[model samples]
Each structure stands twice: as structure tokens, then as C-alpha cells.
Target: MAYKISEDCISCGACESECPNQAISEGSSTYVINPDKCTECVGAHDSSKCAEVCPVDACQPDPARKETKEALLARYKKLHP
Candidate 1:
């Protein structure tokens, strides 16, 4: 599943650079992840880099935008291919 930044985000900008796919961007009040671009770091890393670096643990899986590992890998391929 793709991860989404919650309101708990402090806008510290910690998660932005950690994202391997560059799927995250600054939103009106916080960072937002592009679901189409987010593969949960399936191809680029062992885990979700944004979640790994978020100090506030604001990065969480988007239930509404869930995907299987296979689907995530496919998305990663599409993004990097």
C-alpha cells in the first residue's frame, strides 16, 4: 500500500528526502504522497523510507489506496522502467 502523511505531521520536512521514488511533496499544510508514484519503496529499498525517517510516525499506510506487494512491485517497475 502507498503511504499517506497524517495531520500529526509537523512539517519538519524529514520524510521528503527519504522517499526513494520521490513520491512525496509539500502540500498546503503538510506533505502529501502521490499514490500513483508511491510503491512503498518496493523496488528502491527494503522498507518505506518515508516511514522509516518520519520522526512523528506520521507516515502510515493509506487504507483507501491499498495494494498487494506484487502490485507495488509492478508500480515500481512502471515508475522506473
Candidate 2:
């Protein structure tokens, strides 16, 4: 599944740097995750690095974009390949 950053984000840039897929970026008000590029760190790490490093816990899975591990892995491969 792709992850998203909520309004709670402090725009600390911590999540941006930790994103292996370069999916997180500073939005007009907060950090935003590009769903197309976001693989939830499936190919890069065991967990979402953005959530791991976000100070305010603003990064979390997007319920609307929910996907299975196999689906995520497919996306990760498509992205990296």
C-alpha cells in the first residue's frame, strides 16, 4: 500500500530524506507522498522508513490505496526495474 502524510506533519524533512523511493516531498503545507512512486518501502526496507523517522507520526498507510504484499512487491519491481 502507498503511505500518506497527514496535516500533523511538521515539515521537518526527516521523512523526505529517509524515503528510499524518493516518494515524499514537501507540499504547500506539509510533506506529501506520491502514490505512483511510493512502494511503502517494499523493495527498499522492511517497513516504511518515513513513518519510522517522522517525528509527529504523520506518515501512515493510505487506507484508500491498500494493496497486498504481492501487489506492493510488483509495484516495487516496476519502479526499480
Candidate 3:
């Protein structure tokens, strides 16, 4: 699933450069995650780098867009290819 930045985001920009797919960008108030480009780091890292680097723990999985690991990997492949 894609990760979403909550209201808790500090606008730190830490997660901006951490996204391998360049899925993250600054929004009107906080950094936003583009679900179409988000693969949850399935093919890039063992874990989500944005969640790891976020100081306020604003990055969290989007439960509304649930998907399996294989699905995420497939998306990652298409994106990097």
C-alpha cells in the first residue's frame, strides 16, 4: 500500500528525497505521496524509507489502498523499467 503523510508532518522534507520513485512532493501544507508512484519500497528497500526517516511518524501505510507484497513488487518493476 502507498504511504500517506498525516497532519503531524513537520514539513521537514526528509521523506521528499527518500522516495525512490519520486512519488513524494510538497503539498499546500505538507508533503504528499502519490499512490500511483508508490510501491512501498518493495523493490528498492527492505522497509519504507519515508517512514523510517520521518521524525514525527507522519508517514503511515494507506489502509484504504491495501495490496499484497507481490502486487507492490509488480508496480515497482513497472515504475523502474
Candidate 4:
């Protein structure tokens, strides 16, 4: 599943550089995650780097964008290739 930035986000830009897919970007107030480009780091890392590095734990999976590992990997491949 793709991750979403929550209100807990401090707008510190901590997660912007960590996303392998470049899915995260600065929003009006907080960082936003592009669900179409997010892959939960399936092919880039064993786990989500944005989530791991988030100081406020604002990076969370979006249930609304639920996806399996295979699907995530496919997206990663598509993005990387």
C-alpha cells in the first residue's frame, strides 16, 4: 500500500528526500505522497524509508490505496525502468 502523510507531520521535509519513487512533495502545509507513484519501497528498500526516517511517525499506509507486494513491485519496476 502507498503511504500517506498525516497531520502529525511537522513539515520538516524529513521524508521528501527519502522516497525512492520521488512520490513525496511539499504541500501547502505538509508533505504529500503521490499514491500513483508510491510503492511502499518494495523494490527500492525492504521497508518504507520515509516511514523509517519520519521523526513524527507521520508516514503511514493508506488503507484507501491498499496494494500487494507484487503490485507494489510492479509499480516500482515501472517507475525505475
- Every candidate's lDDT: 0.91, 0.90, 0.95, 0.93
| TM-score, model 3 to reference | 0.97
Q: Against the true structure, candidate 1 has what lDDT?
A: 0.91
Per-residue CA lDDT of candidate 1, range 1-81, in tens? 889999999899988888878899999999999988999899889988999899999999999987999999998898888
Q: lDDT order of candidates, best first?
A: 3, 4, 1, 2
Q: Of the candidates shown, which would achieve the greatest lDDT relative to the real structure?
A: 3
TM-score of 2: 0.94
Model 2 lDDT at residue 60: 90
> Could you arrange the candidates by TM-score from highest to lowest?
3, 4, 2, 1
Q: Write the residue-wise lDDT of candidate 3 on 1-81 in tens digits.
A: 889999999899999999999999999999999999999989999999999999999999999999999999999999988
RMSD in Å for model 3: 0.6
For all predicted structures, in order, the TM-scores are 0.94, 0.94, 0.97, 0.96
Residue pairs in steric clash, candidate 4? none
Error of 2 at 77 (Å): 1.0
After superposition, the stretches of candidate 2 with alpha carbons farther than 4 Å from their true spots are none
lDDT of 4 by residue, 1-81 (tens): 899999989999988898999999999989999999999989989889999999999999999888899999999999988
Of the two candidates 1 and 3, the one with more favorable lDDT, higher being better, is 3
